[model samples]
Target: MIITSAKLFEEILAILKDEDNIFVIGCNVCAAKLRTGGEPEVLEMCRRLEESGKHVVGWTLPTAACSIRSFESLVEKNEKINEAFCILVMGCGSGVSSVANVAEVPVYGSNDTLSLGGSSGGKLLSEQCVMCGNCTIGEFGGLCPKAQCPKGLLNGPCGGAVDGKCEVARVNDCVWTLIYERLKKIKRLDLLYVIHAPQEHGFK
Candidate 1:
């Protein structure tokens, strides 16, 4: 899932300093799961804005704010959205961009978009992928070195790998070591002999 966190209230206030009539939009999916955006978040933001003496023209919680079609449908249903002087998006970067693409008024983000992550534990999200386009997890026994290794190394337990731990991030296990162990357990140790080419860089 795409992780997100609310932007500081001070930062949001600064961005909306010149605007009065604000429309808030939230995502019902990823952002909601992260507690950064959703119906409750949208209502809370509206309350905050109103308490600050700013007008909240309307608010919406789109099923998937990042989806163009979903955003379009929201816009169609929320006529008050057009009455606002500006829009505050309480979702990820993608959701903000989606709203900006079709919004008549200027769009501003109220959340900081973070990496692709999954729940590591209760209310804790840990990044799992960097979306490098070229996936090589199969060779590494499904472990992503790009995400697990601090250096984003493709072929390594770098020279700094020690005692199955990463030298850069001393607390975490070396991803390469995990990969090696997993491969050994699966009897696919020969795959380690195969050298992977450098990842091709550029837009996917």
Candidate 2:
């Protein structure tokens, strides 16, 4: 799912101002987990818009924003939303598109579409994997050295590997150390002794 921010709020407000009846729709699945949109955010925005004299017809949160199956529940619950001049989407791009597809109404996004990721903590979106379509774990012993290492080191610990921690960031565990441990666990530590010669400058 895509991420969203407050910058997209302006675009949403601009499109929704003239609309008399508005339905603020939130998604409980990806959008909720990512802290971008959910019931709380939807209700808050609904109240604010209603206070500003806009006729906020109603609000609803579908369990799965991308699933049209659960969207049936929205019809039974939020019948007033049909009166809405426009539907406000408090979810990612996919969720917004899905809602628009099912509702058959004008959908306005309340958030910007960012890359796919997960939240490690409260509102902290950490990019764990890049999905580069390339694998290099054979040389690195199964650990993602490119992502976990301080400097994305692949060959070995650079000028930094102090006491099994990264020299660049003391709090970070050295990727080489993880690789070494993994190799030892699999009885492949002997592979570490194999020297890797520097490559020539030729394009080949």
Candidate 3:
């Protein structure tokens, strides 16, 4: 899942200041799960737009905005979409771009994509993928230390974890500890002996 946070309402208003007729779009999957671009949020956006003197011609929700085809299919069916002068995407950056790529009107995002991550027990987890480009996750039992660790420890835990909790973010589990447990469960503890080269920063 892609972690996202809503943009300030004032920022959104400013972005749409020159546009009078608007069409709102939301994502039903990642953005919905995070409550950043869900049905309720989309409706709230429409209400706010109308209150601000913008005409909301239509609104639609696609399952996953990153999946361009799914968004395109739903967008093609919206009758009132053509009436809008611009589009407000209550989803990630990719979703906003997806609308821009497929739609004829201008598209803008109302949410900021933070990171690639997952959740546990109905709560957001610390686990994430930074897309560093260099591949080393296989050595850590499918977990990337470059992403999950605050210090981005590649060899092992920094030995600062207390009771399996991270030293930097005490509420989160130590990622290296999680890696070790995963390796042990998979009978790949020998991977700990493998020294990894430094990640190439050229991708940035």
Most TM-score-accurate candidate = 1
Pairwise lDDT winner, candidates 2 and 3: 3
lDDT of 2 by residue, 123-166 (tens): 54433334445655576676765556656655687857779888
Scored by lDDT, the top model is 3
| RMSD of model 3 against the true structure | 2.6
lDDT, residue 190, candidate 3: 94
Residue 76, candidate 3: Cα error in Å is 3.4
Residue 168, candidate 2: how far off, in angstroms?
A: 14
* Poorest stretch of ten by lDDT in candidate 1: 195-204
Clashes in candidate 3: how many? 0
In candidate 2, stretches whose alpha carbon ends up further than 4 angstroms from where it belongs are 120-125, 130-204
Candidate 3: Cα lDDT at 35: 94
- Each candidate's TM vs. the true structure? 0.86, 0.62, 0.85
Residue 64 shift from truth in candidate 3, angstroms = 2.0
Q: Which is the winner by TM-score between candidate 1 and candidate 2? A: 1
List where candidate 3 sits over 4 angstroms from the true fold: 70-75, 120-123, 202-204
